[model samples]
Target: MQTVNLGILAHVDAGKTSLTERLLHSTGVIDQLGSVDAGTTQTDTGEIERRRGITIRSAVTSFALRDRQVNLLDTPGHSDFVAEVERALGVLDAAILVLSAVEGVQPHSRRIMRILRSLRLPTLIFVNKIDRVGARTDELVADVRRLLTPAVAPLGTVHAPGTSGAAFRLYDPRSGGDANRLAEALAEHDDRLLAALVDDLPPDPSHLDEALRAQATAGQVHPLLFGSALSGAGVAELLDSIAALLPTSPSAEPEPRARVFAVERDAAGERVAYLRGYGGQFRTRQRVVAYRREPDGRFTATRGRITRLDLVGAAVDQAGPPGRAHGPTALTAGHIARVTGLTGVRLGDQLGSPAGLDGRSYFPAPTLELVVRPRDPARTLALHAALLDIADADPFLRTRVAPDGGTSVLLYGEVQREVLTATLAEVYGIETECGPGRLVHVERPTGVGAALEIIGHGFFGTVGFRVEPGTGVDYRLDVELGSLPLSFHKAIEAATRAALDQGRHGWPVTDIRVTLTHSGYWSPITTAGHFRDLAPYVLMQALAEAGTRVFEPCRRFEAEVPTDRLGPVTSYLVRLGARIDGTDQIASGWRIGGLLPVRVEPEAQRRLPDLSSGEALWSSAPGGDRPMSGDPPSRPRTDGNPFDRTEYLRFLAQPRNRS
Candidate 1:
């Protein structure tokens, strides 16, 4: 049997979740159609999801379509939950991008399509809400070509659109014009077909059908379809396209290989990992090694044993307990499964071998940071541990602790902030007091500098580093990596970035090159512990000598306000330091788009409604940093003031740091 790990994505209110429900019901997986408004959807089983009427986590369900077993992953659509969508992207075999016919092309929709095309992942566009007023398929097709891609093939046509009686008619491949159109669309990328089309030759209808399917599979062409997931219109044609056009799963490799895209816990409190099999099969109770792809492009292998395995068909509540899973069996390649007992497995870990991962991130790191304190104050340690656990579940949600024992976490925007606050109280039972959001700025070296500490210089290990401005975190060594014990080397290398996390001015330093200029240790006395403490001590000295400059975070924004209210909205945005780049007249309002300092973004969003009398729409995504013209903001000193050599050494002597 063939398997397809299909992902369905969309902007919020685009009806992707509804489409998932429609597909499930049509395939006999659900007895009754699920409703998002009613919070009865099969995939959105989370408490917050049901309450907010939005998907915050990626949910999976499986159903058989003729010879293909479709494992459908319904991903979150809110901009704040892009991290959920990002994880799903790494595991999908092909995707169906749902767009609202009424909204036409949206900001987030464009972002999703851009990533899909960049990955060259096979995509099929489904223009939904054909039954809603103002729905226009004819013009939206042109918009998709102009804004998203030109490699689009309209798989069918819509009739009686924008009404309750709307219907869809798929193109008949056996017809003369339909066959010619398919051949012509493929000809844009196929030289042979282009030549035959130029000669006015009638290509074999079956051959054209095969060519269209092949091109779609290759991601060179996207077959577009129209539908209303609510009314169940155009769904049959979509299933037909999936079974006939999408590529089937490949055979498994001899060495079991897979990539963990998500991690969850069952009611019994077991760590369950969702892995996309790439090269091999994982069996029950099988001993295995997992290669975790760290954020720094380093792959670390950890050993674990698979205690239990479950297929995609049986799943409920990625957060808690659910339907009985069918497993404790072998999970072969091309299939997705929930496996247990691999406690060391983390999200994005490559199991068995790294066959198809590049270790490059598609999303930017969060720039907003907020200092958080538990309302009870005594739950401080609990809050920190809870944060670490949450970060483990979704690596993008990072946390940092201050020297004063205060806690702070990275967040994307206001929505995430609210979600985090609610989650800590709801899930962990930790009521929290969150401070005002502060934009996280970064510092980079201003010049080159170096520092050193030899073994006899008050420490057990000898460490030194040279620092210079560069991109990301580049750590090279003047000495061989084999010069010291691997564990010792790992200690210093790991602490190198942690040292940079809090520079002399109290901001995370970036775009720096650090080289190990000296490495020596006493044979018996020197250990990884000594190196960990000593490395940071030396690195910070080098960074202080080099000096650093701070830059502020910015965001790209799109806003739509009533044409008459545009002036007031623009004025409010400008007051928040937004730079207007372009403005266009949209159907319902004036589409005002620009770049703005992220530090002022939250305030802008808060006031946008009042400025437009609650008739405006706005969205913003992360943007490149801008040079700070004024004094740089200082973060609450985390890392116990690592720049203070004497104080830091004394702090390291404590039992907590010693471990």
Candidate 2:
């Protein structure tokens, strides 16, 4: 049987989990449907998810659709859990973007659509909750086209959509304006299909189906389907479309290569690495090399064996346990499963192959920082260990230990802070107090700068670098091949990355290009470690000369408030340094959107509730970095003159000094 990995994504309360349950039941995977409200859904297995009625983790389950095995990944809808969604996106073959029929398109929906487009993942849109009163499929379709893409083609139309048991007209190429438009769109992509249509020879159903599948897989077209996951309306038709339209997993290579997309702890506290086998097969007890590229352009590897393998949602009989094996067990390509005994495996790590898969930043840098202290200081080590586990699961939860032995965590927003606190208390039995939130900032080189350094203290080597602004958030490094041996390239790259991690202001540096313009090495005394140590000195000197620019995180925000309070809200937003993009009248009242510093977001949340009489809906997400608006604050530069050999040597002697 063929395999298809499908991801179900949506904003919160858009019935994403309910759709998963409906899909499972409609395909005979389960006898009865589970309820998200009742906390009985198969994918929402976590206690926190059950109580909150929201998915916090990405969960997987499988069922049979026709002759194909479909693996469904139900991801969290809340923006705070977007990191979870990013992890799942790397492994998905296709996606179903769920939208609420009554609410239309939302802010996060547009953000997710941009990500999906960037990944070039084929997608189908499902306007769910057609059973709800005031649900308008036509308006919702228009909203999707306006906000997301104009390439969307509706597969069906609804009749009396807001009523119970509404009727649907599934698209058939033989009739209707919608069907004709779909054909024309499909023909635009295929010359033969267009010629056939022009010759008065309508393409056969098989031909049209093949063309549709080809176009959809290439992301040239997106099919739109309307339904209510709660009532199971139009679900079977959706399934048929998926089975017929989406491409199956391609054949595996002779040598297996798999990407580990996620790592989690099972009930037994054993590390479980969830991987998608891109090629070949994985057998029990087979030794495999797990490797990942470090930021410094070095590949780190460890050897391990898969002690066990289990399908994600295998069923159980009266005599056997869940996820039982019926026969010889070996995970083949085009399958998703968990393996045990792979230690030191990180997210985005590749196994049993040297595919040179580069790591990708799925989410933006976290902006909120909080100092955490355990109630009992003695439990500090325990708190650290527990946080490590959480950080492993969500890479965005960056943790740092300060010089004073204080622990600080970088987060996306307040909700994540609350969730982390609750999870620590419940899972690890550790009580912790958190300090007030602060905004995290990053620094970048403003202009061209250069530096050259000669090692003197029993170390014989010289390194030089030219630094300049880089494109986007990339930290790019290039070496002159003639200046150094090929073997030393990795070391140089790694050292440069380490140097970039700390700017003069003690923040990570971004969007900088460093080129190794010159290098000289002498004998056995000169080693990679010497180069690593010498790198920071030259890089920091160059950064100081170039001058660093500090950037604060900004967010694009949208809020709907009563018309009577529009003036006050607009003035309040402006006072918070928000650049109002536009204001429009809506059914609820007035909708305003603008960009503002994330530092003021909490204040807006606190004040808006009272200002709007609790009738406001607001949303915001990271909107990239911008230079500080006013004159750049005077921050202390590196102490002493970097060009002074004596002073530089003394600075290097200090153990805590980056050099």
lDDT of 2 by residue, 1-659 (tens): 88898999998888899999999999888899999889999989878789889998888889988888888999989888888897788889899999998888887788888888888788989989898898988778777876788778788889778889876678787664544567776887888778876886666666677788888888888888989988888898899889878877878878888878777778987988888888878877889998776544457888998898876644455576664755536677788888888867877788888684766665686777788889999999899888888887777788776444557888877778888888889888999989887778888888889888765643467888888888433444454566666556667777677656567676677778787766888766677766766777788888888888888889988899998989999999999888899998987799999898877888988999888999998977678777886654332234333344577667767887543
Candidate 1's C-alpha runs over 4 A off are: 173-185, 191-207, 314-328, 455-458, 480-486, 522-527, 557-595, 600-620, 646-659
lDDT of 1 at 503: 79
Candidate 2: which pairs clash? Answer: none
Highest TM-score: give the candidate number. Answer: 1
Please give the distance, in angstroms, between residue 433's alpha carbon in candidate 1 and its true position after superposition.
Answer: 2.4
Question: For each candidate, C-alpha RMSD in Å?
Answer: 4.4, 4.9
User: How many residue pairs clash (N, CA or C atoms closer than 3 angstroms) in each of the candidate models, in the order given?
Assistant: 2, 0
lDDT for each residue of candidate 1 in 253-320, tens digit (9 for 90 to 100): 77778888888777686888998787667877889888876665666789999887787764345555
lDDT of the candidates, in the order given: 0.85, 0.80
Q: TM-score for every candidate vs. truth?
A: 0.88, 0.83
Best candidate according to lDDT: 1
